[model samples]
Target: MIIISTLVFFALLLIGLDVGFSMILAALIGMVLRSGAGIDPVMAPMTLVSSVDSVALITIPMFVLAGEIMNRGGVTRRLIDWSAAMVGHFRGSLSQVSIMTNFIMSGITGSAVADATATGSILIPEMKKEGYKPGYASAVVAAGSMLGPILPPSIPMILYAVMANLSVLRLFLAGVVPAILLCAGYMVICGIIARRRDYRAREKASWGTRIKVTRASIWALMMPLLIIGGIRSGLITDTEAAGMICVYALVIGLFVYRDLKYKDLGAVFYHAGRTSAVILFLLAAAGPFAWLLSESHIATAISQAILSISTDHFTVLVVVNLLLLAVGMILEPLPALVMFVPTLLPIQAQLGIDPIHFATVVIVNLMIGMLHPPVGLLVFVTSAIGRTPIWSVAVEVLPFLGWSIVVLILISAFPGLVVWLPNLVMK
Candidate 1:
């Protein structure tokens, strides 16, 4: 039954079915066959409702709405200007600017697709005009945009927390150091490339200009601090932080920036709703599929199989990373999270690995997958927005990919990188 269900799921995906629906169909078949009875209609709806009933889930849409408002509200322009002013005097200024902009935007949006779309639209063209190769420009955008999930207030971290029965706040904190490391790693690679390619730096900005740009972007920068600080200070729940950020973003967009008008709000809400719905649907479908695996003891079976191979924690960790890297290449992170995290949680316990560390590693792996070719969502997004060919963008992303893998290995080998911030803050 498991073999058949797995085949059906992949087959549906191959035929271009929506991931949410494909998961549901495959699960339904498995449930019916395993029960040796016709499908129990109550099971599907019950699973979905239970999966989404959590108050924690509300943050997903709130964060989505916040990102939408910020994007349309002219926040991206301010962020870009601020990043350029701060780093434009350095060699590879544009590349450095792209990385810094992604870091700031990651705090605001927490969605790599949104980040790639927003940043690529603005910076890719500018980079090309400034003599950067289109492929390299697009590659930088795609690679840096991945910071969205690795930074705090991330939707993927929230989902992983709920799935693993871990603390959302802790998971959010856990990502901080690793995210900073990745940003630094990207900047180092960018600097090297800049020197080799002789990319020119802009004249240093005057203090007057720097102050003006900083003043303009201060409010935009405050959004992440407010969310993270409020949560860490115990002044607000994660959901409340998300809601407050949404309201703040709306006000900044409609009144302060004046870029997002009342009329534009409808489209913003519509887009947020659409993106949120897809995620919720995927979560709902994943509930049943995950339940089936647990019910059939498939998760335990896999755990036992791994333990049989080797009991050494490092060996097991390495093996699991390889498996996740392969799975990430083919699957979107959300669905992949739903399908695999449950199965791996048992193995995680057997090895006594920290949940927060495992979650961080899983997210980093999946984010890297977003850069891989063929099905990499961000690859397509950057290519289309930058007007670069997918092949060229893929080729250009190779160096950034190598850098990301190095960070992944470092984080995995030293779990302290993923856990120290969480421990200090949460304790």
Candidate 2:
């Protein structure tokens, strides 16, 4: 029953079915076939609706709305300009700007798609004009945009924290060092590639230009600090911080930057609403599919399989990373999280792994999956923007992908690297 149900889930996904509905229908099939094994069809609807009952879930729409406002309000433009001025003098300067811009944008827009599309549209052309290959330009955007979900205010981390019954702030904190590490890895790869390709560096900005650009982006730069500081100081919960972010972005968009008009509110709300609705529905459907996996004891089987090979901590961590990476190659991160957080989270505790460490590893692995075939959202966005073939873009992104794996390994092997910031701050 488990094997057949698993196949149906992936089969539905491969056929271009929407992931949420695919999970729901696949789950219905699982219940009907495995009803004797404590899977009840009648409970599926209840599970779907009830899955989104938490107050923490309120943060999704708020953050989504904030991101939309920032994107539409000229915020993305200012952020990009600032990053370019500050870092575009380096070897592979444009590539460095892409990474730095995405790192900043990650705080405002936690969605990888948002980062990829917003930054890719602006920078891919600029990079190409500067003599970068279209495929490599697209590749840089796809790789750098991944920082969106790894940094604070990340949407994926919110989902994982809620599912794992962990603190949202702590999970956000846990991502800090790894986010820096990933950026460093990406920059190192960017530098090496730049040297090989002889990518030209821009003239260093005059101090006056740097100061002027930085001053112009002051409000944009304060955003992440405001959200993270507010939450870390215990002045607001994640949901409150999100609401504050929404209001702050709106004010900045309407008054400060004056890029967003009152007339644009309707479209902003509509788009944000649609995006939020899709995620909530996926979360709802995931409840039953995940429940079905639990009833079938798939987690236990996988856990036992790992232990059979070896009980050593490093060996187990490696095996688990491999499994999640495999799951990521097929399913989008959210659905994969829905199905397996229940499955592997318990196993993580059983092995004495830290939840924050495990959460960071799982989220990062799935995100890296976003750069490759089948369902890499980042690759598709950048490819379309750069007018490059997805196949070619995928090839160009390989080096960044390899460096990301090294960062993943660092976090997985050294729990202290992942947990120390959160432990220090939260304590």
lDDT by residue (tens digit), candidate 2, 1-427: 7688778987987888988888888889989997787656987898897789899999999999999999999988998889889888889999999999999999888998988888988899999998999999999999989999989888889999888889998999888898899888888888999999999888998989989999889988898889879998889878899999999999999999999999999999999999899888889989888878877778898778888888787788888889988887887888888778887876788888888888998999989889878778788889999999999999999999888899889888898999999899888
lDDT, candidates in the order shown? 0.89, 0.89
**Candidate 1: Cα lDDT at 259:** 95
TM-score of 1: 0.97
Q: What is the lDDT of candidate 2?
A: 0.89
Model 1 clash tally, residue pairs: 0
TM per model? 0.97, 0.97
Clashes of each: 0, 0
Candidate 2 at 139: error in angstroms? 0.3
For candidate 2, give the lDDT of residue 259: 96
Cα shift from native, residue 74, model 1 (Å): 1.2
